[model samples]
Target: MTPALLKVQGLRVAFGDKEVVHGIDFDIAPGEKLALVGESGSGKTVTALSLLRLVQNADISGTARFEHDKAGAAARDLLSLPERTLRGIRGKEIAMIFQEPMTALNALYAVGDQIAEVLELHQGLSAQAAHEAAVQLLADTGIPEPARRARAFPHQLSGGQRQRAMIAMALACKPRLLLADEPTTALDVTVRGQILDLLADLQRQHGMAVLLITHDLNLVRRFADRVAVMENGHLVEHGPVATVFGAPRHPYTRRLIDSRPTRDVAPVPVDPAALPVVAASGLRVIYPVPRPGIKGWFTKGEFVAVQGADFRIAPGQTLGVVGESGSGKSTLALAALGLLKHQGQLDVAGRQWAAGGASDRGLRRLMQVVFQDPFSSLSPRMTVEQIVGEGLTVHAPELDVRARRARSLAALADVGLTEDQFPALLERYPHEFSGGQRQRLAIARALIVEPKLLVLDEPTSALDVTIQKQVLGLLQRLQRERGLSYLLITHDVEVIRAMAHQVIVMKDGAILESGPVGRVLDAPVHPYTQKLVAAAAT
Candidate 1:
């Protein structure tokens, strides 16, 4: 049998006096796929970064031996390699695709140039030759209009296109091993599947191994041959994917396997005469796009983000909008929040928004929104008190400072945060808290206004599985306590099933199906809905 392509023995990663990745061991064979599964802060990313010595000032001690077939290139210790030698091997033989492609890529340069840079650096290709190769690579990754896209800057491409560009760069050199760190975590479900399939196809063609670092179990089931479960700093379980998932030996492994979101509660009937928290009829949202130089002066083109739509969210009920990226879910949320202009009728609490009037101000207090990615959504410079109380200032400017503080504290308490646990709760800034805590702070910020309807746009998409569960539970409790309404916008079918009573499946800014969660999820009639469910379940 062929020997392992890469072997890690007693790997440890440390920063100053703290050790985060304890001694761990694993191996990857040629043309193999191994998934490193764990929650946030579980040492998964650090472990992968340590291998390539990419962690800044991180003290990594381990024997990461890479096996090569060339002369004098038999097993060599990558951990002990000098800086220059490691740089030579980084993109040429061992490549890495970071989690966020947007930030990973250079904003100043076009994506094609980025790929050409790698080719020129490793293969010593000429300027023209590299340009040709780069365009080819883009085409290989399934990006349309390769030459045109290659000329486009990183920001010009969509999320999926940018990710595809990143993949094209990573595989430009035909590396022996690829380390993908949550490659699809930020992408939509359909795009995630496409990226995974692309990786699998590329791996087979290049005959390279993959070390995938992610918390997504479905990706592991579909892609990996072996799985390694990490908890805190330890490798709790390591074995074949089927074995580990079918009969996990470690308690942590079992918990991880069983962590998929489950239905929490059934919908209780509401009064027939009661009005919906939010209502939309024939909702159409259109944006003006730039036309070509000649046509620009005559007429601007229009991009319809949301087609004519109709839906109603009963008070105390969750209306879930599930779809891929660019689907009208977010657009619908924006329309419902009165942030964007729409053609059709949309009312909040039986009232239509009157732009910048007393009615609009009152509606703002009635309906608030919680955006995705708490870390970025929350202002870094603002203290907890200021962040939560800022809404109060806009809604109830007449209130005194002390009254606002009391209300803010009460709102924080409702979301399970208190001054008792965090003495500097009011004074502490966003950077001081963890991801989950930051989300809680966001929730408190939203609740401080006493909103009747909350437009939650992918609330738990950025959180870990366990943290997501906790946040969902907190939201559920808040709904029960306040009889609040929620417009949950997300791509995760599991989250929709768990939290939503009514579900709407959307594609290309159009609703494919809408009904009770169980009916749509369990027995989806539309092909798109069925595809989504199948992709999620596997």
Candidate 2:
């Protein structure tokens, strides 16, 4: 057997008085891929961070021995190393690729400058040499226009391109080990596959070990050689990927493997004359961009986000929009919500979005939106009662304080949040609840006004497998009970398969195909749709 490149034993992490990661043991051979799998708050990320001593104010106790490849270099315990020695080894021997590049990367510096900084610090290269190497690194990561992109800031690049640049920086020094935390969770399906492939290729070329921390089981299955299951800070199981996934011994592991989204949505309405909650024809949304060169000095140029699109959501059916990033699915959804001005007709509840009219205020009550991230969407300052009851104030101003409080309680109850499960549920803030519970609160807020339609924007993407399953089940039950129409916008094909009756495929701001979900996904007519399906399968 090959020698272990990294070995960890009896690892524990604690913050203040609360312990997050219990004692755990694992090892990674040279060029091996190890996946630490768990849901939210399961302590998977904490374990990885502890290995690098990156967690601030964290009391970490462990024996993490890293065997360097340099001649006569002794094996060192990472936890006990001196700060100066560790700094020398951080970017040169071991590097990390964070989850969100937008937050992890410095906005002030250009991407190429960031990568060159790493080379200058660890590799002892001159500024001119480092800059050229940075561009080459970006090229190695499969980025187009590498020289030009190196000068762009983090916010200027697309999501996938930003991730590629982050990978470029992490691998600039050719580290022997890489720590990737949820690297592809924020990416679309096609882009996620591309990143995985890129990592595999680079790992093979450099013979480096990878410790991937994520909650995505599908990603683990596709990329990891060995799998370790973590539940509530405890290491439950560890084995080869085939053995673990084929016959998971622990119940938590088994539950995760079985948590793929299942179909349980309400049937489509049979009546042909049923009025649509939202109807759009020739909807076009354009944004003014600064024209390049001297033309920018004269006037602005138009960029069409959504071009001449047509779709409808019936009284009790779901219309799922599937596409890659920058494909304009969210823009289409915004137009339907009357949040953007369009060149075509968009009717919500039998009325158009007029300019500050009384009818528009009433029309807002007919539809409500649930955003992608509940933590950011829900106001942190507001209590549970205030967050859920705020909608009632606008739609039902006739109700007094006592009546509003009563309605809020009922809404919370309808979404499976009660005083029994959560003590002082009304008074507690958003941070007090877990991710799943926070999403349930978001759903409750949307359903309080008794709207005819719900615009669900990537509702379950931020959740893990089992939690995602539970949330989808909740949405299905609510839709069945309330007969709610949904304009679902997501890049997840399996989610579209399970929840949508009708599906529309979009690519580069245009609808490529539209039909029943089963027909379109299983037997796609368009090449782009087929490409999407194939990528998801892998």
Candidate 3:
């Protein structure tokens, strides 16, 4: 058997007095794909970082030995390597593709320049040679118009494009190992498939070992040869991917797999007698593009984010817009909530709302939105009470300060948070809360308005399976009790099966299929819809 390329034993990482990762062990064979699966705060990222000695201002203890393929010499302890020696190994021997490509790439530099930097630093390539190599790498990663895109800044490219650029940069130096963290998290299903296929092809061609960090069990099952499950800072199980997923030993692992939304589980029936909350028709949003000419002119592109889309939700039903990223799922929600410019007819109960109008009191009172990233949506400087009560103060100024405070606390309780927890949390900022708690707080903020319709945009994407299940249950219970309507936008097919009464499959800003959840999900007609379902199932 070929010897392992990297082996880690008893890895522990700590931040000050708190130890986050409690002794984990794993190994990566040459050209093998290994996955670390866990929920947020489970130390998956920390473990990957520990491999590179990148954990800043933290105490890390472990033995990470690297054995070169060509030489049968003694294995080198990576942790004991001097700074200069480790630097030589970092990008030259091992490279990492970070989760958030936007933040990972330098905003100020062109994408080509970033890739060029890696090539120049490691390979000592000249400027022109590096630039040419950068374009070639981009092309190799399946990015179209590589030359033009290479000159574009990170912010100018789409999410998938940015991810491809990151991959290009990482592979430019021809490293022996690749560490990828949620590499396809925000991508659409088609792009995700392409990225995965690309990774597999590259791994085979280059014979490089891969250490993948992700929460998507389906992806792990499909791509990884070996799997390691982590929980509460410990590696609970590790084995072949099929063995671990097919016959999970740990309770946490079993729960994670079972928590995924599936067609077998029936959605709770919602009452139809509740008030008509939100209704929209023929919604279309077009963005202006700059014309390529000397004259200062802009041309309107017919990129309809929500093209002639129509839907209605009673106060108690969840109309799930199921699609990949950039499929106009979020665009539909934004249009209905008057958050973006659109040509559409929208009515909240009896009141008509002007598309993208700012002075629609009825729209504001009738509908509220829960954004995907609670950390960015919630003000980091504001306390929880202030964040939750801000809408109350704006809409119902008649309510005094004390009344608002009481209302905020009540709202917190409605979402399973308590006032006792509030004393510290209320005084603290959003960064202080865990991802699940932050989402709960976001839900509380939306619930405080007591609106008839709530637009939830991928609210559970960042959460663990167990936390997602609880949140979905909470939404269902709230809908039954308070008669709330939900316009749920998500890419998780299981979420649609479990929570949606109706499902609309979208692609390229158009609806490809729409029907009752059971009919569309179980018997999808459109090829795109079928592809999405198939991709999700694996």
Candidate 4:
């Protein structure tokens, strides 16, 4: 067997008096792929960060033995390395690809310049050589028009492109080991697969070990040679991926494996007398964009986000919009919610959206939107009572203050959040709750008004698998109990399969396919839809 490239023993991490990570042991062989799997707050990321001494003010005590690349050099403990020596080892010997490239990359500099800076720092290459090398690295990562994209800033590139750029930067030094922290967590299914393939190819080319930190078990199963399970800083289990996933001894591992979204949605209502809660025909949302070259000064160019989308959500039914990022799924949801200006017929609760204008509180009362990131969506300044009952203040002003407070309490209870589970739940602020709790608060806020139609835009994307399962189950239960109509928008195919009665596949702002979820997903006619399904399967 090849010698272990990285060996961690008796690792412990603590902040002040609180120790998060207990003593844990693990090893990564050269060219091996090791996945550290756990939910949020499980301390997987802290363990990885501690390896490189990147965690600020963290009291990390461990023996992380990293063998030097130079022959005959002594093995060094990475945890005890001097700052200057660690700096030399940081990028040149061990590189990291952070979770969100948007936040990880410097916003002020061009992406190419960022990568070039790494090359110049470690490789000591000339300015022009590093710049050229940066473009080549981007090209190697499969970014289109690499030269042009290199000159673009972080925000200028799409989510996938930005991630690819991060990968390019991480691999520029050909490190012996890579620390990938949730590398594909924010990506769409197809793009996630692309990144995985790119990483695999690059890993093979570099013959480097990878320590993948993620809560996504599917990704771990697909990509990892060995898997280590973490639970609140303890290494619960560790073994080859096949053996561990095939038959797990640990209860936590079993629970995680079984946490995939299950199909438990309410049966579709059948009544000729019933009308769709939300309906749209030829829905088109167009935006004005600046034209390139001299034409931009005089007139703007038209960009159609939702192109003639035709869909309807009958009572107690879910119409799922599935696609990649920027595929117009969210735009369609926005148009349905009366939040975006759109052409063509859109009706909510038997009333046309444009006829009453977007400001019609009555129409707005019939529909509510739950955004993607609950942490950002729920205001930090507002208490739970204020956040949940704010909708009632606008839509149900006739009700007294006491009535509004009662309604907010009821809403929170309905979403499985109560004073029993969380004492003083109503008085607590958003930042006080966990990510899953914050999402529940968002749901409660959307539900306080009792909207007939709920537009959920990637509601559970930010959560761990177990938490995601809990949130999805909550939505399913709410739909069943209230007979609500949902315009669900998401990139998660499994979610669409589990929750949607009817599904629509979109690409480039056009609906490629629409039908029963079974048909669209299992036997997709369009090539693009097929590609999406295949990517999800892999």
Candidate 5:
């Protein structure tokens, strides 16, 4: 092991009169990879933010002594450093890679300009040199066509691309210690692996230490040398990754490690002879691409999103679509919902949507969708009652106000929301509830319309592991009770194992493999499925 690079001792952070991060201690040795693992609201992010005194308007009392790489140079306390001096060390010595790249990167400037700005400020490189270095950094991060991409704005690039640009900026000056806070949380499984691999490659090349903060235990197992678990502001466990994961000393640590998705009960068997609630065959979706200048006027090319896909979801069954970011899982969901124009046959509950509104009105009522992020899926301005009851107006417009109110209350109660438990439930807003509660509200809003098929696009991906299990259980129970079918689109193999009865592996806008959940996941023959399963197991 190398010598210590940074040591955090008696680290405490308080907001107002309440202490969120109790006194804790940890250390990162030279070129070491240390992971801080904990669930959301467990103070993992806060702890990482406090290392550089980045948290605003908070009481901080700690000694985060950072050993200068220079031989015999005295160690300085980062926590107690004066603002003027700390600014010099920020990007020049130690850099941070934020979680959400879209929010972190500048919207006004090109990606290359953003990276160049970092180099210009920290390394004092001229504009031309900094821009050249930024392009080289983007290429280093595995972003193909770096020259063109470096000129692209954050919104113009894909999610993975934006994240790579963020990494490029972080590594522009080659700092000694890198702080990554949930760096891969927003990425797909394959993309997450790519980012981690890139980090490992750069870490080896630069010989920099990494302090990773994430809740995913699997990531810690694969990437970290040592692990530390925090719960309710207290550091409960700290040891080598293998040692801590193999034998967690604290109950909280054990629970966090044990929270992986597991199949507790046998999945309910779907009758193969029964009619499918949702059916699609040779479904194809394509978007018209605009050509440059005068060529665009002559012809418009097409980009295929979902190509030649076929699947069926039986009544009271879950059909999981597993794939990476560009795999067209969500495209298939949109096609199934009649939200996009497609070239193949797709029927829902014996009927398909058509051009005529009068003809498609009945088919539209049979299917609904629950989106990925509950916060964005739900309307912030509306009250709980309004958000849930809005569906009733469209589906059962003949019903009077009194009957609609009654049905809305019943639907809310169905999803575990009751005025008895939550007083003023009808008046409460979505922001007032937790992530799990907001998802329940989303489910209620979808269920209030009594749709036979629910298109769930990464429904639990935004939640913590335990919360995901609870939500999946709730969805399963609802399916059993109401004979509802789900088209579950997600990248999580564990989630597919726990929820789906039938599974299909999608790649490059096509179905690579399709079979029973156990067969496809446990005994996958396709190389893509094999890779997904292997990654999940790790």
Candidate 6:
């Protein structure tokens, strides 16, 4: 039998006074694909980081033996490797693709420069050679116009492009092992499939073992050869992917699989009385793309983000837009809120607003938005009070500071946050709050506006399953009490089934189908929509 490429035993990690990961054992064979599945804070990422000695300010103890190519060789304990020696192994023998590409990449440096830096550090390549190789790597990762895009910074690329660039950088040196932590979390479904396919292709061509850490069970079931389940820092189960998925021994794993939204199950019907208070028609948004350099002075190209998409919402209704990444779901939401420059017909609170612009205070008064990442959206320097009250300051300036404070506290209560927690939460910054709390804070801020319509762009994507359920329930309750409408944009079909009354299926900036959530999801008319629903189901 072939020796394992990577063997980890009795692995444990602890921060000061707190143990995040208990002793766990696992192995990866040559060219094998292994998945670490768990909820947030489940030690999946910590375990992966521990393999590279990247766990900071923590006490890590374990045996991690890496057996290289030669049969007769000295086994290296990766946990005990010195920094310099570990650096040598980092990008050349082992590469890691982080969860958040935007933050993982440097904003100031060109994408090419970042990729080149990896080659220079590991392979000692010349700058010219590195740049040329970087372009090729980007192309290999399925990025378009690799030459031009290589020179662009992280901010210039879309979420999918940024993720691809990160993959290119990780694979530039052809590492023997790759650690991918939720690499497809931010990508649209189509782009996500492409990236996953690329990873599988590279694994085959290079015979590299992969450790994929993700909450997405669908991806794991499709791509992984072996599976390891973790819960609250413990390794609950590990086995062949088919064995574990088909006959899940762990209750947590079974719950996760069942929690995933499915077309097989019928959606519960929401009463018509609980419909959206606002609606839109023929929504369109076109962004101008400038040509290269001086050529842009006279030439321009238009990028249509949302094209003639129509939907409606009665009071307390949640309308979900489901599509792959870059399918213009968010663009449609922005257009609905009049936040993007678009040609569309929108009615909020029975008033015409899409004809006017987002800048119109009247339109702003009728709608609000809660973004995906609360850490970035909320002001890090400001207190929770400041963050929540900012909307009131803008839309209802006539309200006194005392009145705003009372309203903010009430909003917090509406979302299940207590006033007594205010002393600690109100004065504290965003980083102090947990992921769920931060998301609740975002919802509170949106609710403070008391708008008829709220645009939620992947609000629960970053959260764990339990937190997601809680947040979903909170939104439903708040809708019932406040009579608010929701325009939820997400790739999560399960969320749509749980909360949406109407569903809009979009692709390539156009609506493929739109109808009642139950009918469309149960009997999808469009092939693309059916694929999306199927992908989510398994």
C-alpha TM-score for every candidate: 0.97, 0.98, 0.94, 0.98, 0.95, 0.87
Of candidates 3 and 1, the better by TM-score? 1
Candidate 5 lowest-lDDT run of ten: 261-270
- Model 2 misses residue 127 by how many Å? 0.7
lDDT of 5 by residue, 169-210 (tens): 989999999999888988888888989899999999999999
Residue 496 error, candidate 5, Å: 1.0
Q: How do the residues 296-368 of candidate 6 rate in per-residue lDDT, one tens digit apiece?
A: 8998988888888777777666788999877899888876776667676776666665445444787787788
- Candidate 3 local lDDT, 1-538, one digit each (tens): 8778998998899999999999888899989999999998899999998888998987989899988645768887888889898998898889999999999999999999999999999999999999999999999999999999999999889888999999999999888999999998877666788899999999898899999999988789879999999998999999998898889999999998887753322344556664467777887888765556754354444456678888777657789998877888887887777778878777678677664445687579778988888888899888998999999887888999899988988898999998576566567788888888899999999999889888899988777777888888888778878878789999888888888888899888898899898899899999989998888776
Deviating ranges (above 4 Å) for candidate 4: 355-359
Itemize residue pairs with steric clashes in candidate 3: none
Q: What tens digits encode model 2's per-residue C-alpha lDDT throughout 1-538? A: 8768999999999999999988899999989999999998999988988888999999999899999768668878999999898888887899999999999999999999999999999989999999999999999999999999999999999889999999999999999999999999999999999999999999999989999999888889899999999999999999999999999999999998999999998678567686778888999999999999999999999999999999888888999999999999999988888888888888887688987567587788888999999999999999999999999999999999999989999999998999999988899999999998999999999999999999999999999889899998988998899999989999999899989999999988999999889999999999999999998888
lDDT per residue (tens digit) for residues 352-408 in model 4: 766454358888988999999999898889999999999988888899989998999
lDDT of candidates 1 onward, in order: 0.92, 0.92, 0.86, 0.93, 0.89, 0.86
Q: Which run of 10 residues does model 1 get worst, by summed lDDT?
A: 262-271
Cα lDDT tens digits for candidate 1, 1-538: 8788899999999999999999999999999999999999999999999999999998899899999659566798999989998899998999999999999999999999999999999999998999999999999999999999999999899999999999999999999999999999988888899999999999999999999999998899999999999999899999999999999999998888777786666475967687988888999999999898998989999999999989999989999999998888899899888888999899888899777667589889999988899999998989999999999898889999999999989999999889899997899999988888999999999999899999899999998888888899889889888888899999998899899989999888999899999999999999999999988876
Error of 5 at 18 (Å): 2.7
Query: Which has the higher lDDT value, candidate number 3 or candidate number 4?
Result: 4
User: Which order, best to worst by TM-score?
Assistant: 2, 4, 1, 5, 3, 6
Give the poorly placed runs of model 6, Cα more than 4 Å off: 124-132, 261-276, 291-301, 354-363, 392-406, 419-425
Candidate 5 CA-lDDT value: 0.89
